[model samples]
Target: MKKPLPAAIAGAVLAYCALATPTALAQPEAASAMEEMIITAIREDRKSRGATGLDLSVYETPQSLSIINAQTMQDFGLTNINTLLKMATGVNVDPTETDRTTYSARGFDITSMHIDGVGMPFGNLIVGDIDTVIYENVEIIRGSNGLITGLGNPSGTINYVRKRPTNALASSIKLTGGSWDNQRAEVDVSVPLTESGSWAARAVLAYQDADGWLDHYSNNRQVAYVVVDGQLTDTVTLAAGYTHQDNNSDGVLWGAVPALYNDGTAIDYNVSTSTAMDWTYWDTQSDELFAELGWQISDHWLLTTSARQIDYQDNSEIFYVYANTGVGLDAATGLGLLGYPGKYADERDSLVLDASLSGRFNAWGQQHQLQFGVSSARSESEGLSYAAQSGFDVMPPFPGWNGREVPRPAFAAPIVSAEQDIDLDRIYGSLLLALTDNLNLILGASAVDYTNDGVSYGVPTSASEDGTNPYIGFTWEVLDGLNAYGSYSDIYQPQYVLGEDLNPLGSAEGKSYELGLKKAFANNTLLTLALFRTEQSNLEEFKAYGDGDGIDDTDYSDDFDYSLYRGIDVESEGVEIELAGQITGELRLQAGYTHLSLEDENGDEARTFIPRNTLKLLMTWQPQALPKLAMGLSTRWQDDIYFDSAYGRIQQDNYVVVGGYASYAITEGLSVSLNVDNAFDEEYFSSVKYEQVYYAAPRSVNVSASWAF
Candidate 1:
């Protein structure tokens, strides 16, 4: 039986407070220092890039924003970007494949990503696999940011900030062990290269090997990162870094097992069940090199230049099942027929360059700021695929489907299956004008040009498009610590699908409207309320024939004319409320609630897999008496979701998940921590589609110890 939500929340809060109050009251001096440290951990003091590409405060930004700091990441043991995103406000994860995960905000799929303000391509796949150890913080903007991103989705954008080298020597090492034979070790070190602190270097390394709850599944990973910073002169600085990551997994599932039998009857399976064969495997590797240069031209003017190159590769072999209405397991043997055995390999490379100049001046007795920048990016991808010559004929039928009975099959020579290239160029500018002491206006625009060229199975295709987007916003100080703001931003994206005329679908365009109120308390806490709407027209939708007999559907290997598009108009609207920062000297909290609605031109709900109502709450407490101990708790809830499946429409019920963590300091430089996830062991589906459903992970425990010097 599940615990009642309200009762569970109340019990946890009361217990935590009871454990912290007495100890805190006994020691006032230690409590004062702890309060200051807690406040610093939860709040950011440095200026950061906002919607207008200017350094701004969270209370002054016109768009909805959320920042997750390094302290919170460590408290929850968030090792990857996927784990970090699960706790963010108004964000939902959609796991399409075992290795691919996508995020959605406000009913729209989020596709834009940045690292230090530079754009990154193929974010959906990269973000899920990247480790979080190298990042200092993550910033999310929950509305359109097309002025800076150029061509992008209207959903939102994510920016990852890396940790920089410190002039002083610092080092930390950690070891972890957890449920399911999981083991991990990591090390981080920073050192000063010069006595005057003019040069510095930093390095990070991590390794992990884990066994999954599912039978025959296991994972192995390794990562290495290094960075160097040099003060070349009094007014110039240079920084460079390199990162490499490799991951390998055995018994990776291509898709989930069938949800229903042939007669539309549900099939019950344990959460630990898997359909993958023992020989199935997936591997990925990535390498990146980046450099940045900064120059202080004058007191009010500065220039920055940056460049990056990335190489990524993926290889996989898997067995597939094409379950349909008539497919069913054998009654006598409980065995099902196999569909196909496939082998795949893919490689991608990207190069990006950016330069920007910002300055401030006085005009008409008022101060103003302006920034201008230009950016160019190019990406290329290639892939090869091979399948068993006899398809299902050479594959053995599943025997009870335990993932260990099937034998590997022979495959034919791989053929060049896919090749693609994309290039983007943009120039953008923004201006901030101070109309009055309490009123500020932001204006920005960008001109973008993009091209896509590809070849597949001896066929060639290409497309080119250009567009201009504008942004306007204002923030008014309504009171001493409260502000009112509104913004309108435009978006454009080139579609890759072909239309009825055999040419590529035209570019999709959209606009976002946002209005919000923000308040900053003297106690270092922030509260925000936001209302937003986004609309897109000329969106592409695929049209397939009932039988694979149409010309557009017959040529499966060609890149062009593979699908006919019917126009689509989509609208997504939502309201969000958030609170974050220190609530008291020894307590820190972050909470958010969101309500969303989405529809298409025909008034039909779109992206039905995403929930309409979601809530998240996280809190941490430190006791003065037990000054060496810190405790944390978090809760997440989501409303019911309805989506269509092959059998029929399926409605998933609402669910709640709880997590807790505690850390104890053994000495000045040594600490130990324990983390428990899904404490109530809630049962639910993490992702669903017409043909497959993935079950959520059950309860798990992890414990780690760290030492710093």
Candidate 2:
């Protein structure tokens, strides 16, 4: 096994400590007025996802949490959720195909998502396609969040907060142009509807058209959002909002090209190589409506209720490739005889309702905070698929292939291949007790009811399960500005697969243990170090037999009673360290390092896509001599990973990517910015599977101008 920490990361740690130690030891009284003002600004920026729920600071929270504010998003040019996940600590983005992306944390894929603290399910091909322009900030909680997210994975939870209406009139407009014929425009405006400023409204619009580096690949996207906020009475408030998004893409690849030839020789292709036909396309449309009501019962008591409805649709026509070891593409002719052309259409509808009451009270001569909430979510989806009878095409392949020359194939009529309905209801309660001025205890529990009904390929199945999860933690003030904490949490997720007896498989369960230390400095900087371990059991594994007699020779589906069993067990252990906030009045920084080890029952490494060692750093500086100009740098480094393939084991070497950005305030209300990614132009594979591989983007640059009023 390779060493977990490399020399490059060690050097970075030394540099960070040298730069931060002096400021960390400085006295608050010795700071200048400008420094004090900057500290205040940092404090304001630290407030997150507090209005709806989980109103706690990073230093005060027992679990690991990271926040990416709007300012960081603009500085780094993180326009989409995928880019944001790449920058977040301990998170990995795995690209399965051109239109499908999955996120993993702590060796497990993340399935729990929330908008403004309301639970939302994330799945299918459209999960990563959501635009980030409408969000004010994003919060990532890394651990078992079952106490709040009920019937979810142990990997973690993601919460997005929407940009709300401003009390005062504000507006902004931006125009951008980048490499690959990328052009984008955005407009945001907020106004006070009433003279007294009791009512307000806001609107945001954005559009983008971009051409990819690969041959015959392009995309267009549009988004529109509007919201209204009103203070109905002296102690009551209401908000309503709607969002719509449409995305269309041409020449989307279903799978990457073959990695090896028929003669057992590795094939090397250019970075812009593509295997998609010009006629292939994928399109998605989504619409959402939400409303919230809040009542301030007293100075320390509040009640909130929220509801959301979503409708999503996806339509696609794709040409997929499958390359077997001994029958790969011909080396001399540059042609392959394996292809599958298909058409699919899917639609989903979802509705969610949530209500909570939170308050603080005096009990047993101590201060305590308590919260209770109930939520219900329902979703239904239907899909149709069509495929060619004999999926084989004669066309130029590999080095000399052009998508335009391949003729489109004919497909049969569409059939209902899959339909599903899922419903979940949960009730949860939490209490924070201040045992003393220096000691605190947290207690939480959730009861969840889940049901799933689905039909796949003419096979019908249904499952219903109920479970309760519990959580406990303690935080002690070790020093004047430092805290020590530990927590224990568990999660449960129902499985829909059936066993040989045709009964639903047992549910999967997991437990997490975490301990950490957090420190807050006078400059508003936060430092955190944590150790964690998660154990999962009752994972589903499938097995096939011949004639229902447990023989392995027969390969016919009709003769076999293929079934799933709950026997797999997985464990992941790791350490994480993070430092964030303003290091100085002119400099702002965010840096994180993570080390993970994942293993299954056989003690073999699991989840190869998740690197064992990862580091992420971002820094911004505004020189005193050039107050009107700001510059920043960001970098990410990860360890090597390997996956099993038909030919052999495939290994991807470790790599480091660096990016930079600069912005100049030309005038009071106008500014210009430039961003450059992959400054070193290092080539690496973004994703790799047994049959396909996706390459990362090359060097790219973008320039933008914005005006605010």
Candidate 3:
């Protein structure tokens, strides 16, 4: 584990205090003198020294953007990354029975993930934590972000902004209990270190435990986060942060028995009476460290830089009954025989450099708001996987069965590879001109360079060099309180070695055009509509190159050809419409919807995993009218998927999931809340791969209470 430099720095500061505090207190007039010293210290901090130049308003931004504020998180009782996805627009998370989830944005792979504007290549493992108390907001920017984020898919970028300390001290403590013995507790605190509010700090801690709906399924999670900011002088500021999370789970409830009974009659997955036993267990942990420094060169120009490092590890055990049909059913329920089991480890490091300048300029007697920035990021990922057998017994097929591990795999040769490291860079410039009070025109473009190297289970050898991507966009304030915008962008992805002949693969290219409208109605409300088309060319795919299963020692190559993907997207897109400021006085309402249509131009379903249609809706009601009450409802719909497969054409029917929440105030600083997920207990499937169907979770409830000071 790498020690944090911030900790060492804190220790040194504390040491200095230990030696000086006593002497200062010893002075007879020290009490009055100390007050003056404290006052002076605060005045120094208030000189605007350590402040970031970045603006926080989402509307003032150039592209389509969304923000999930802290209040929205609590009203919906969204703690985990999965819950957040369900509540967001145009984002999808497909969770497999194996407990692995894949994320998708627009019509392309969701490759861009950031924390506070810095790229995080290994977002899969980093977002595993379920602590809503840690983040201040989730910021999403739609379209090519190469200019701001460097190397990334043109579909856009989503960044999780952490909580920061405010001058006024605030803290909250929460406790939760739910069905199936599920329980949780959390705390969040923020304070200023100086009276002048120059130095500030924030902290968050959380824990959760649950006994799942399925037999032998259980879960435990823990999280801690801390951050601090300080102003050193008139021109310099510094900030440091840390986060840690741990998760333990019994396993995922993959899927149930096939719909067909032995007699071939349509039957539900829950109706199967066949003898069965399966178990899955996994443990995952992660730690993150970050630091930043800001230098204000002048009033019109500024520079900022930040660095982050992430480390993660995982261990898993899976067991299930297997029948070859040709061979008799095996009774050996221990390791090595039943299902898939493996151990996974990952280490990643990242660095980011970002700087920008914005100021008003007079041209032809017209005032223009011009802004430009250059950003760069480099990241590396190293992960190792180990296969083993189960360590438990097989219980007969049933709804709820809890069993212990009966492990078996001994040591084996370690297969080592380095393929996850990524290096990316970009430079961008933009100019926005205010044609008139209600009219505006903007033009922007960016140039990017990216590279990747890695080997996966299927591909033993893989390496790709830097590829350039270009982007362009325009925005026009068409009418009073209405804005229209359009953009064109491109992105590229490399190839990995599959089975045989270095699978001939080349750079995959993507191009998209979008048009949207933003309207502000009476009473400070906002409404927006957007339509977009995206096409991808030269797509790389995994195809069988040999006669065998493509397993074992076989000639394989990183070879693929350009395929195509095209799709259209529509989103309601506005925020703070009904809930802008006044809602039942204290009651506030927020809501929106998103619709998407994606297509695989190759028409080869077996090669492309993209879905056709996705729909999402979210509504939040916070009644200040009652002073202490809040409620929310959320729904998601994924349309059917039809595509070409090796065996035959495959189709996955669409399904809908709904969730709701309600909370009440116990006092000015105390509150309680309840949440319901999959409220109808409806059974549905999210995906099907290799003829295997993965079902969604069942009805679940959670109740919580909180206190703040």
Candidate 4:
């Protein structure tokens, strides 16, 4: 019999959760409405400057963009970015580890993450899912971003806008419990430090714990955030904030299930089967602080400066499984999977700084906008490794095994595993020319100096680059509420792969071109259509795998994660269509579709591991007659993806995942919500790069109560 999915939550502080409010599912908006939204309904306002320092609207940004505000997140119970991004258009959330995720867009790996228009740098090979409670909204920019983001990555950029302190008193608490013993609690409070409201502070804290669908797996998370904002004088504003987070997962998979047998036949393991031993675990902790200064030099001019620092640490003791012989993996007996264990720890510190001056000036009898800025991002990573105890390899489940069959391995003396530094410094500026009342042109460029020094995992991680990249765009108001735009930008990404001469290769360089159209309708609605193409060379392609000594590297040919890289040029072209905003007084909607094609210099298809088509849709309805209730549904669909590896052909056919939610207001200050993910329980693989793959999670449900005051 299936176990009951119910639980009692502790701490019932009755603050309003703000659950039933009919906040418009606001999408990205243009720059014409920033001022009025400064202090009211800020979460519902569409203000995204993450693409360029200059303030611009989503339709005016000249790129494919998407935005999901706090209300949308709360409505859907999207407390984490992994689940949040899944409902976004043109994005692929690729899960490589149970606790980590990699995002890709436009057929390229995303390399940049930003908070409040500042770059956040991390050089780790492993990245965990980020909590979203500290953010007010999330903006996704799809395409090459080289103008201000120093790094010319074509995959796109993810920008998180932190929740600022509110001038008025407000408080909310939400408690949730559901399937697999999942439980969560969050508290938020904002208060004016001064009665005049010139000074304010806000704090938010969250905790979560849950068992897993995978046997022997359990996890817990904790997060805290504190922020203060104040108007020191009539024209000066200052803000400072701090955030801390911890994630721990036990009985985790160091390696996933083997997809194929030694005999080359597909092996289907039980959905609940986990290769992790009872003693294995992975954990990460992070803390960050930031400060910002804004000076209103004049009515139309402003100066802003910000600094941020983050300290991160991760520790893990993992066990790896592999085939014992040529025909070792026999699914029938499960005798072929052998285990190898390792212990690792990494401490990473990153800092980012930015200063910009922006203002409006009259040029040619017209008002024009411009911004100039300098920014730098630095990350240093150091790690320690311990030798594992002997005989640990023979302890995994074999003939008649259970999770506890093997004892925890003893570690030998710790040794330095890595010492590395990655830094990027940039000087950039942009100008918005008012060609006419209905026409505008934007010109921007950045001069960047990037360097990577030291070694990681015995490989020399040395690279230095200095160059200038340009960006240009044009937008025209074709009709009363429509816009047409075109954009071009340069792309750059450093490489660590060795060349034929055993030296590092040059950076991958490319160009991106995009043209699009957007329409704005009543009820805060937006529609967008875009066509884009990008081309690049020096993208490390597969080379021979050997000892991995920068010479004859010893590795698998299709090990995308560690495969040897050789310079290769590739091109990708795609089309995207999207819509966001209220469809009617009773309905709010957001949806998008993308079609992409990628090819190598040889005209052969490239990166077959990435799908060519994807679509996402989400909608909410609240009838005026039934003002106390609201409901929503979301869907994600993708084309098939396949990759050939040492283990054989790995393919995932096209599939769709659906989710639903509903909320009811019990009172003006209280509400409750029910959320169901993977509603149809569709079985599908979330990734296929490695021999061991992961199946998407099964259907899960959650119910929550929230109070807002």
Best by lDDT: 4
Best TM-score goes to which candidate? Answer: 4
TM-scores, each model vs. reference? 0.88, 0.88, 0.77, 0.90
lDDT of each: 0.73, 0.74, 0.53, 0.76
**Candidate 1 structure quality by residue, lDDT tens digits, 562-670:** 4366668888898999999998888998889999998998899876888999998888999887899999998889999866764566666899989989999999999
Better of 2 and 3 by lDDT: 2
Relative to the true structure, candidate 2 reaches a TM of 0.88
Point out the worst 10-residue segment of candidate 1 by lDDT. Answer: 14-23
Ranked by TM-score, top first: 4, 1, 2, 3
Sort by lDDT, best first: 4, 2, 1, 3
Candidate 1 deviant stretches above 4 angstroms? 1-48, 126-128, 325-338, 390-399, 458-461, 496-503, 540-567
lDDT score, candidate 1:
0.73
Indicate the TM-score of model 1: 0.88
lDDT for each residue of candidate 2 in 1-709, tens digit (9 for 90 to 100): 1111222321121100000111122233422432332222222232433311344567878888888887898888888888788888888887767778777778776777778777665341243267888988898888878776775466777888788777679999989999999899989999978775567788999999999877788989999999886656554556778899999989988867666666656678888877888999989998888777666565566676777778888999878665522455677866654555778898877877777777678999997878788888877888888756643554456765687655677788988877778888999888889999989898888899887887655556577789998888888998998999998888697765665555567688988888999999968799999999999987654443223344443112222223444457899999999999999999999899999999998999876767999999889999999999999999999999866565555567899989989999999989999999989998877775334676778899999999999
Q: Please give the distance, in angstroms, between residue 219's alpha carbon in candidate 1 and its true position after superposition.
A: 1.5
Cα error, residue 508 of model 3, in Å, equals 2.1
* Model 2: lDDT of residue 458: 54
